[model samples]
Target: MAEHVLEMKNVTMQFGGVVAVNDLSLEVNKGEIVSLIGPNGAGKTTAFNVVTGVYAPTNGAVYFNGKHIVENYPRGKMKKLYAGTSRGVYTKHIEPTPDVITKLGIARTFQNIRLWKSQTVFTNVLIAKHMRRTSNIFTATFRLNRKEEKKQREETEELLKILGLYEVRDELCTSLPYGLQRRLEIARALATNPSLLLLDEPAAGMNPQETAELTDFIRKIRDDFHLTVFMIEHHMDLVMDISDRIYVLNFGALIAQGTPEEIQKNPKVISAYLGEQE
Candidate 1:
């Protein structure tokens, strides 16, 4: 049996009268690239937000590396939040904030480019590497952490080379071409040494050629780093080319899920794309 890296069991997210993700459950096994796809307003990004701890779920649970990371949704006025309750959503749990989850081997890139504009590509990635630094401020200021800092710089440099950003290492992050900037964001996430990577619309705004390059890049990174990826994407070609499986959402509900070939032929997915469903 495959080891699961991430699992969402009956996870739902609600805001007053709106349910952003409706009892959606899915799993990504270790070393697989899974994609979430849907039309606009399909709740794909919302689901990502939930997984990364931007918003707590209204019900259900999420697990990372076989450990419960999110559970026990408290509500003042929730009706469906507890529908079809199972064993228990309660467990020894800590509110898994985004940074906390990142430390637990998950790292993510946002839909918009979020690089530090004034910082160089090298520094941007180096900053992410600092997340795991152990030296206290006293040691760091006194150069007691010199050895660790040097090691971190070397690692970040190697990562930049792998991502093909080494040549522009000294360039301001915002000055790079759009595609390279996107790659930099990913590199920053990789610096955190995550087992699972979440990419939001990685192929957005890319031309055909750039998108194709990104497809290859994603596959290479996954193979090289032994990563399991969960991405939210709209570019069908990119999603279909590299995903091990695809989950399609419609109006915050999972409407279809399968291999690329299967999802491509699904009637519900077809209808969602054509906007034919009412």
Candidate 2:
């Protein structure tokens, strides 16, 4: 059996009275590609947010690499100000900040393109490497640690090449085609050197052909990077084509989970997607 890289136990999130995720438990094993699919507002992104520390679950716990990080890091200055405290307060066992969770070897891409639109593609990816860099900002800015900077640059370049964005490395992100921009986002996430990657709607606005290419690209990255991927995507074809396992969510609850073939035949999934069509 593959080693487990992520585990969520009875995770539930409530927005006032509405439950965004309810008693959801799932796992992703090492080097596996898992898909989270559901109708809109099924809490798929909510699950992603919880796992990545965007929102602490209203109930339950999440573990990454066998350790709980839902509330592991110190809260940032802003959170401190808002909460009227400087000391990091653990909220329901959740980590106080997303940065700490990320440092634990998980990274994510947003549903909307979150690239620095003003920056060049290379610059966007280069910035991601900052989180993993050991040198202080002073050294990085002054080029004081030349060896480290060189090593980081080389790694960045290789990642860009792998994502096929090396040719447009110097171009502004806003100027790239939408499909390339999405690829750039994935490349930037890869720059963080994560053990687990959470991609939200990676195929959101691509043509069928582009989506097909992206399917292959995703698999290639999984093998090349040796990382586990948990993705929330609405593109059924892409999800079915690449996922080793599929988890179906509806009304903020998991309704079905199985191999692609099994999920395709699931009555609940059919009802959710097709809505009991005549």
Candidate 3:
């Protein structure tokens, strides 16, 4: 059996009266490029936020590499507002911060470009390595972490060179063209040494050519680094061309999931994206 790198078991995220993700369950196996695609406000990003610890799920659990990273049961005032299918299934609560999630081999990029505008391209990537640093603040402040710091810098330089950003390492992050900025964000995520990379709309603002290049880049990274990719994308061309499997969402609920060929022919997916015919 394939080892599941990530799994969501009856996961639900609710806010007051709104159920953002309702009993959503899915899994991405090791070394697979799985996609979650859907229409606007389908709760895709909400599910991503739930996985990365940005939000505590109202019900159910999330497992990463066979370990439970997030598990919760709705309680308190939420009991009255909870409208999900699985409310009492989760008996324990486990909510870690986003940084903690990153340390556990998960890294993500936002739907919007979030590069540090003031920093250089190189600095942006280097900062992501801080999460894995073993030295204490005192050692870092006193420059006693020279060995570790040097190692990190060396790794950063190699990563930039490999990702084709070495030439513009000193360029201001915001000054780069939109495509490069997106690449930089992904590169920063890679610097965190993540085994699982979650990209939210990686091709959001790209032209066809750039999107095509991104398709190749994603496959290259997944193969070269032995990483599992879970992305939320709307670009059907990219999703169809590159994904090992695809899951479709509607109204925060999973509507369909299968291989790209299967999804392309799924009537429910067609209805969700194109609406009913007269």
Ranking of candidates on TM-score, top first: 3, 1, 2
- Look at candidate 1 and tell me the lDDT of residue 180: 95
Task: Name the top lDDT candidate.
Answer: 3
Best by TM-score: 3
What is candidate 1's lDDT per residue for 1-278, written digit by digit as tens? Answer: 99999999887777777777888899999999999999898888888888889888777788999998887464555644444333245443345789898999999999888899999999999999999999997997899999999999999999999899999999999889999999999999999999999999998889999999999999999999999999999999899999999999998889999999999999999998996735
Clash pairs of candidate 1? none
For model 1, the superposed segments whose C-alpha errors exceed 4 Å read 79-94
Q: 1-278, model 3: which lDDT tens digit per residue?
A: 99999999999999999998999999999999999999999999999999999999999999999999999988999889889997677899899999999999999999999999999999999999988989997997999999999999999999999999999999999999999999999999999999999999999989999999999999999998899999999999999999999999999999999999999999999999999988
- What's the distance in Å from true for residue 36, model 2? 0.4
Measured by TM-score, how close is model 3 to the native structure?
A: 0.99
| lDDT at residue 114 of model 2 (Cα atoms) | 96
> Which has the better lDDT: candidate 1, or candidate 3?
3
Error of 3 at 55 (Å): 0.3
Q: What is the TM-score of each predicted model, taking all chains together?
A: 0.94, 0.89, 0.99
